[model samples]
Target: MKQRLDKAGVRFRPHFKTHQSWKIAEIFSQEGIRQITVSSVTMAHYFARQGWKDITIAFPLNLREMDSILMLPEDVTVGLLISDSSTASYSFPKSLLKKSVFWIELDTGHHRSGFSVADFHILTWVIDKLCSTGAHLQGFLFHDGHTYNATGIEEIREIRYNTLSRLSLLREFLSEKYPGRNFLFSGGDTPSCSQELPMEGIDEMRPGNFVFYDLQQLALGSCQPEDIALSVLCPVVASYPDQGRAVIYGGSIHLSKDKLTVGKETIYGVVCSEEKQSDMRLTFPGDLPFLTALSQEHGVIQGTAEQILNLVPGSLARVIPVHSCLVVSNMKQLVSADGTVFETLNLHSVDF
Candidate 1:
């Protein structure tokens, strides 16, 4: 991964929202990753406490958290995303304006937020206001979130091209219209970042989920099962041979209900008997396919009576989550490779 970014001449400022561990953050810091991206203000604070000097809250700046933002250390360089609203421009405390860096987000392909590339007049107006405040207009940042919906490599490539084209056009417009204005062009998504990066005009890339990939990335052809670094461990509680089903302690509370379906086949989660065992095999038998039908306090596994009978009640099962981000966020704690329990990090004060 480092070699790939080095070859492209693009700096990597990995998003730390995937694995919110201070230990992992230190690893990146030691690797010379000075700058990092996060999803919330609390995350910024958490990593900042862990000794991160530069942090960018990729989401829109929260107007209500102005006081909390002000309390951060002055040496900690902070960047906030600004969009159509002048709220961030006007609401930000005048004292912090000089120290704060504002990146006008551009909506290239994903219609989530930010001023659209086509809305040149409004974008320029926002930039003018931000520049007037003397707050450093730190380039542009965007995420090609729509890449997740891509069905094949061709679609992924098209999304990448369109996103880059849009961003380049906007950058060129900014350059010609306002020359000598220093700025950085940054964009990334797990799929596009994992495949190949085209750093024509981009200065930085922020890929979050690559640290702990999941089934969604696998289904999208982004990464293989070997790239997946996390899974849920659940103990089989019961086996109903008559109904060809078994129940596990892991359910919606442990592993989320998110599922991936390809044609008629549905894979809720990949099952393994152990975590440390490298030769761990998934529990789907040849004759009876395993499926997680319902999940609450129990994960209902479906298969043939013979296959169901084979699973012992006291056995342990490891289930690979369909969406690692959501599953990890839901978990309050995680066990490391050595079986040490570490509390899961939380950024959002309110549950999403």
Candidate 2:
């Protein structure tokens, strides 16, 4: 994958929030992935302790964590995201102004936290303020998060094209106005990064979910089921022969409440029997056909009596979650590809 990315001239900075394990992170590090994108300051500290030199906290800056931000090494090259608010402008400790890098987030179309391209005055003012603070304004960062709402490949392509076009226009404007000012145009979302979208203006791509593609990504055409690298193992505890339903120990706490279904059938999670490890077949039995509902500690799998007759107590079933990000964030540990248990890395030790 590294060679493939290298051949495409796309610099990779995988998001560590997906699998918060230094051991998994070490794998990427061995592949020459020095730079990484994390979601929180706590995560930054965690990875920093793990010897990651270049880290970007991809989420909007939480000003309260300024002290934690300052604790990072000066040579580590930390990059933060800034919105239009004056909060971020004065949030950073003046002592580390020169040590940190900043990325002014632009709202291409995601309408999340960034200033829109149409709000040029506010953006320019924010840029000027950031520059005045003596901090390096690295570039513009954007995430086409709306791609997750895409219904098909065509809509996904439109989101990708429109996002890049807006960023490209902003990049050109920035270049013409502030000539010779080194600026990067970084943008990414799992769908945009995984697809054959044009990434000409994008300097760096940050796609976290690609590392462990989930069932939602598979349904969206972002990745294949084989590309999914993680799955939750649950023990089947009971079966209702008459109702054609089975109860699993896994619930929202383990597999998450996220759902991905077609029409009336609810496939809250993909089911894989233990026997089908090498060739896993995702099944949603007919009749009571659905991995329908999830409570705090149980997942109600609705299916036919004959379909679930073979499932017995103590049997292990693999469940693929709809969203890996939410699942991993809630889990305390992760099992590697080799079936080794690794403790989750703690992000922030001290409150900011």
Candidate 3:
């Protein structure tokens, strides 16, 4: 990701929500990444304590977390996301707003959060409110999350172009309205950042999933199969080779419930040996050996007769998740390929 972003001359503030491990962040620091992004104020707190000065909480601003946000060290710069006017004016202290970096999340057709570029009235209203409240207007942010629905690179590139064009027009309009004001535009979805698209109006790229490409990104042509950096290790609890089925001690709790369906088959994950994640291969309906269905505490692996004939019930099974971030979110820590242990922020805590 740094290679692609550096070559394109775009600032890389990678989202730590993918790994959520401060130890993993050390690896990023070794590669010269100073700025970062997270999904919650607690994450910002975790990384801030790790000495990350520039932190952007990419999720929408939570009015309840104002106290926690304000408690951070004075030097730490926090960027908050606001999707509507109410959140902007609800109860942020004027002094906090004075030092805050406000980002208006833009809905470039994902329909998730934020004002759509077409809904200029609400968007403009939110922007005006934030600016009036003394928050530093940090310009627009668009997540091409919809790009995940694309068929290939061409579709992803098209989404990227269209989003940037819409954002550019918004930037122009804002600049014309407020001359000499420097509004920094920044946003990135994994699919958009993984490709060789042009970074024109974008100021910085904050892509989380790119850090650990998953089966979803792989299917979208955003990354190669080898680029995936994380997988879940499930213990084989039952083996039925004659029935071409196996049961593993991994389910929604371990891998999350994210899945991908191609033609007649639904894939929760790709089950493979320890060495070759791509070796078992995932094809629609028939190529064999995929994590076909998942229950709360068990996962069903289905394949051809020979595919699972060698399985031993006591052994461990490796499964590549469809969405790495969701899988990582469920894990309390990460076990590397080399058996190294890495700790992550425990969002599952009762306090969180």
Model 1: what TM-score?
Answer: 0.89
Best by lDDT: 3
User: How much is the lDDT of residue 262 in candidate 3?
Assistant: 60
Q: Give per-residue CA lDDT, model 3, range 1-352, as digits (tens).
A: 8998888888999989999999999999999999899999988888988899988899998888888899888888898898876786676796677556888888898888887787777877787787776778888777878898998899988988888788878877877877898878788788988878898978899998887898898888887777888878888999999998999999998898988986678889887655665553457655547888899999999877787875579988878889999888888889887889888887534444
Q: Write the per-residue lDDT of candidate 2 for residues 32-132, one digit (tens) a residue.
A: 89989999888888888888888989988887888879888767888888976766557466766766789988787888888786676777888888888
lDDT of 2 at 66: 80
Candidate 1 per-residue lDDT over residues 87-106, each given as its tens digit:
64584568678557888888
> Ranking by lDDT, best first?
3, 2, 1
User: How much is the lDDT of residue 314 in candidate 1?
Assistant: 95
Which lDDT values do the candidates have, in the order given?
Answer: 0.77, 0.77, 0.83
Q: What order do you get sorting by TM-score, best first?
A: 3, 2, 1
Estimate TM-scores for all models: 0.89, 0.91, 0.94
| Local distance difference test, candidate 1 | 0.77
RMSD in angstroms, candidate 3?
Answer: 1.8
With a 3 Å backbone cut-off (N, CA, C), the pairs that clash in candidate 1 are none
Q: After superposition on all CA atoms, what RMSD does each candidate show versus the true structure?
A: 3.2, 2.7, 1.8
